[model samples]
Target: MDTILDALQEGRLFELLDNDKTDALQFLAHIIEAFPEVPAGTDVVGHVMKREEAMNTALGKGWACPHARVPFDEDLKCVIGWSPEGIDYGAPDGKPVVLVVMYLVPENQRNHYLREISFLARALENYPGLDKLRKVEDLDDIRNYLLDLIDVSKEPSGPDTRARMIRLQARTAPETLVFQDLSNLIVEPVTLVAGQNTEPVVLTQNHALFEWLDSVKDLIGRIETEGVYQNGGWRVVRRGAVNYQGSRIVYDCVAFKLIQNRPEKYK
Candidate 1:
């Protein structure tokens, strides 16, 4: 779903053009023309126009990502276009628009389309060194720059790393669980050693909690007898939230549970 990198790698996404918006539209038409299953020529233009009637996808960074969720059999496709001279498209900033990245996605593919839009939104949000975008006159340069930027963006963003732990499904409600940066959670650093038993296992889902415990099963199994942690495949403690009176204390901390569950509501 990462932009420019995914688009260029897909091969059919790139489109070189002169300094004009009409060319941009025509180029997009050509790209859709190649996909005969979705009709052709002016039909593609009609799709774009219909979507545009709802709202301008242009957020005004001298760029716009016009998109439509068209009915199709396969995944999504992107058609990239550039105009060096820039054209008046009534951008929010009242600036002339120079580049257009059109996204055509299948209606049924909600996740892929949303993910692609998210990636595109992030890329455009940074608007980092967009003067480079102004200079790109052909498809090759655009492809190279886009690929390079996407590569740079992959180097472990802190929030992104935390978010990676939970494999969120598209149909899953967004108000149940969320990723919160531990760095932001505390006023100062709170370092805990690996041996710290008091450290709470904070997770919103059953799988995540189980996964963490499963990863450190050896440590848990040998804690009482050996008083040491070792890598071994052993049966670890499984608290089913049923036992009231037991040799060891095992109770769900409502604070930690609430902490893990609250963030998704805000999102």
Candidate 2:
């Protein structure tokens, strides 16, 4: 439940643009690949598609869970894609699948992942608002139903965060939404994910990007504040603001990828 709730809270949930099962899974895999936890060359889509060919993952009642497993040990991550129109997933129940939850499983969290899926199955079967989920038009509503199924404990979220989530739910599918305005970068938190001699990918948030940004913090070795940037041989490649509901969450995005043969610290 935490993994699923974590995905929802971080804006990992999307209104799926593709209704075909392969396209939908591929779309979710594309998002997963960008995650810093995923090794640079992991073929998430290929792995998931191969698994799907072995068995249909649809849980009926318009829900499907597609996942890829890897050998690395890292935090479990997932992204949820909602298709109100439902995808023609080959479910045993003969129902079109509308909710596709894709998980990235690693060696360390295998047992934990199984338990979570078990709970999810139980909760969804008895969830009172299952029917409502099928008909909802707003992504926010879809998120709410999924959270409710998990019965997540309430946490006090800021207004900006709430507004951003609402905005993300309302938008047409874009690979990502980033605003560039450096004024706020002086005060906001930004992160960078990259490799040696490779172009870095900028990821950031200020409480409005659904909390997913936190997962990458582990991949960062350390950030030493110097003037406006976190230094230690790292430099800002991008400065941008995520604007939502009149609030701007700015970031000074630095970058990294698992450094080779470093200290046992990373191990």
Candidate 3:
């Protein structure tokens, strides 16, 4: 999972002028230059441009993920650019684009490119920060947050997937507990399909948040099954450091409470 920071750790992602469309193209060029992992010359840019022509990568809500695949001797690389003020990207919303994530993949590695696309799109689907990015001043913070989001989502079978599956389970009711077992967990309740469905679905911000929540769930499961209920001699232990700022359980608990109190829409 290539994070926003993973793409920008060495100052790889750039923040360019909203009006500088050419710079966006140049930004792609720079990624090729910086990472020899990508193929050289017009081929790289042409691949990117060709993809752009196929469908404006400007995914709405001020975020665009532009990507291309070409023959490469190396693995893969990503280039990212941000336009916090938003750029006049030819998008359906015409709201301008604030984030641009570029991907360069090897021609033989079709699966890798698909995985990258899926990972990023899933993160942005319920992203709670389209409004927040408008005000954030620190680029590192944004980069790190994005990185964490990607890292947590890629896990196949683990507590992270379990926690996400729990949230997925909660979709059955008009209101449900988006609970997690961890302490000081960051949870953001996303009211996705707010009006489209009669039932309220609890959407999480990203997989990292889910991973934290999943860990908590595991701990809780251990307590219920192994310690509190089954074993005769048991002691509660603080097994892991709690990051209250981004813990999923703590954040989702808040969301659950709010949903419980709020009026439910019949339509």
Candidate 4:
């Protein structure tokens, strides 16, 4: 459940275009192709569509989780398509599907994916916000809604990081990744450090802070910049770009947790 929710938190959530179930599934699958975790030349569409033909993935109550299995070993990644105007997804209960949570299952994460899905299944059974989620028009509302599924309220976002963490839900236009936490100015070519072992992401509207990053991106890969949402002194190793449905550029990075006390690192 946290994995799916975390995916949405890290900007994997998108407003789906109005179309049939196949189109929606393809739409989500196409997004999955852009994920850094997914291997290049991997036929995400082919695999998902082929699997769909064998068994329908339309989970009743406006949710459809279609998945594809890959041979590579990586984290179980997913992208969600939120259709405000539901699509006719040929559900067993004869209902339109609104949330399409498509997953890319890796060899190592099969058990983990199953566990998350199983937990999500039970949680959704009693989740009392179906009608509310159906009416969600803004990405901010949608993100906040899902994050609340498993309240991280207890997870102690210390005062030092509390203010920065609050901006994690960067507000955006209906179908755009337009950053708004910094007065909606912009975070173009957003370099995301995929918190594989630490905090979820590091997105700042202050591009000047990373101006040197673009200049040396080709020369060096994982040069740590002065912290922005840099929690627990983790090492954010830059991987590469992860282009999504929107025009916004995203990079996949893994943050390895470690303890440190470097005052000079903080700007």
Candidate 5:
């Protein structure tokens, strides 16, 4: 399976004329027309429209992902469109959608299709490249900016990039823990509170972990994991433990073993 960046390069990327006449369906139709290799007799626009009717694909913050599954020979095909003035996408936040990324995947590639959407959504949720994308006027520059954004997402977590796991044990309460990481791969913190007397509580600020896991899975597509690691592909490298403020807090580092071998590169 090709990475999202690879598929994007193989597909089309262009800018749309932002006007009072443009709507969601028109935007989707434009993308469908851009791809000529879509199998004959395939109603690409209808497929996408049907999916949209089922659920609004508009993700707030000026972004929308409209996808369709079709009878195609290839795993997937993508087309990214940018509208500077934005369009009324009926988003949850009621914000105009400025970016539309449409995916047309083969029916058999269910897992790949889902993974692609997940990655794209998470990548754009807090992407730092949006500002740069808005500034560039040329099509080639926009493409390069997207490639650079993907390159940054594919960066390997190094020694400096670490997640701090804090295990907090209270006096009467059983125990609670938090995983905080400043890695470029995931910038949010995951906190889990568990104990015998109290109900378990989980506080997640964002989909950072989900995004990282998906990216790693895509990087190691279909690879066998025999000697990868005894503990299921993840190895918790011990950093150290510490006691603080009436709680036993343990600090440890977590990383994916498979990612160490395969560093991402854009060709």
Candidate 6:
């Protein structure tokens, strides 16, 4: 089975300028023409739309994965499109779609197709990664970003695993704050919360706040708060280090919690 990176690299990535879902699919079909494995009479758009008729493929956070299993004997193929202005993809979150990843797989590759889709859904759930994807203008950069994510995903899961987070303070600051996992990508404006009068503000999962605490930083101990209603909302707390200008800054970061008002699932 071809990995996600293999499918991505073997496929095409381009911008879909000001087009709806149907038009976007058509454009992808045209792009797929360059692939020699796809039969000359294959109806790429038709296959995708037929799948959509059964169910919309929009997986929220401004992403959609529309796929179809073709009657071919080739490996899985992908076509990734980015729409900076967003498109109406019928997402459950009511958010316009910014990224569309289309897949054309062989009929016998059902397991591989499902695994790829599931992995993408989990990866897209990371707000920080989604935020970075929105600002990606270069196609190569987008490819590299996805590749880096695959590497990060391979890192062993443990108590010390660190999820990516954005340092809200540097959003508007002149100096650029960079994280190793994520490069110099600017934090999306939506991730920042307007503070009342303090430099320290309560961070949320939407803000990409909590993850594993860095032990190399200052000697402050980590604290885990159980189901607290403080910080203007109900959230679990875990202290972690955020990399800022030449130092590791520690903060009482808020972690994700199961709440009644949680955002709807992206189907």
- Top-lDDT structure, candidate number: 2
Error of 6 at 233 (Å): 61
User: Weakest 10 consecutive residues, lDDT, candidate 6?
Assistant: 183-192
lDDT of candidate 3?
0.48
Q: Cα deviation of 235 in candidate 3 (Å)?
A: 63
Comparing 2 and 6 on TM-score, the stronger one: 2
**Residue pairs in clash, model 1:** none
- In Å, residue 166's CA in model 3 sits off its true spot by 28
lDDT of 3 by residue, 41-122 (tens): 4355567777777888877777777766766545556666667666777877787777777776667667866766676677
Compared with the true structure, what per-residue lDDT tens digits does model 6 show for residues 98-182?
Answer: 8788888788777778876776677666535666766776654565566656545552332112212111222333542221112
> How much lDDT does candidate 5 score?
0.48
lDDT of each: 0.48, 0.62, 0.48, 0.59, 0.48, 0.53
**Poorest 10 consecutive residues of model 1 by lDDT?**
183-192
- Stretches of candidate 6 exceeding 4 Å from the true structure: 1-3, 155-267
Error of 3 at 25 (Å): 2.5
lDDT of 2 at 176: 40
Clash counts per candidate, in order, are 0, 6, 5, 1, 0, 0
Model 5 C-alpha RMSD to native: 23.2
Q: Give the TM-score (vs. native) of candidate 1.
A: 0.50
Off by over 4 Å in 1: 10-23, 36-42, 155-267
How do the residues 1-267 of candidate 1 rate in per-residue lDDT, one tens digit apiece? 343333443444433333445445544643443443454333565677677767776768777777766666655667666565676666798877766778776676668777666765686667466678768766556654565455445533323332232223212434322222221111111111233454433232344334544456444334334222212211122111222332333322111121223334333
Q: After superposition, how far is residue 199 of candidate 6 from its true place, in Å?
A: 64
> Ten consecutive residues with minimal summed lDDT in candidate 4?
178-187
Runs of candidate 4 with Cα error greater than 4 angstroms are 152-267
Q: Put down candidate 4 lDDT per residue, 6-114, tens digits, no spaces.
A: 5654667767654457666765675566454566568787889999999998878888889999899988888887887887888888888878889999889999888
RMSD of 2: 14.2
User: Whose TM-score is higher: candidate 2's or candidate 5's?
Assistant: 2
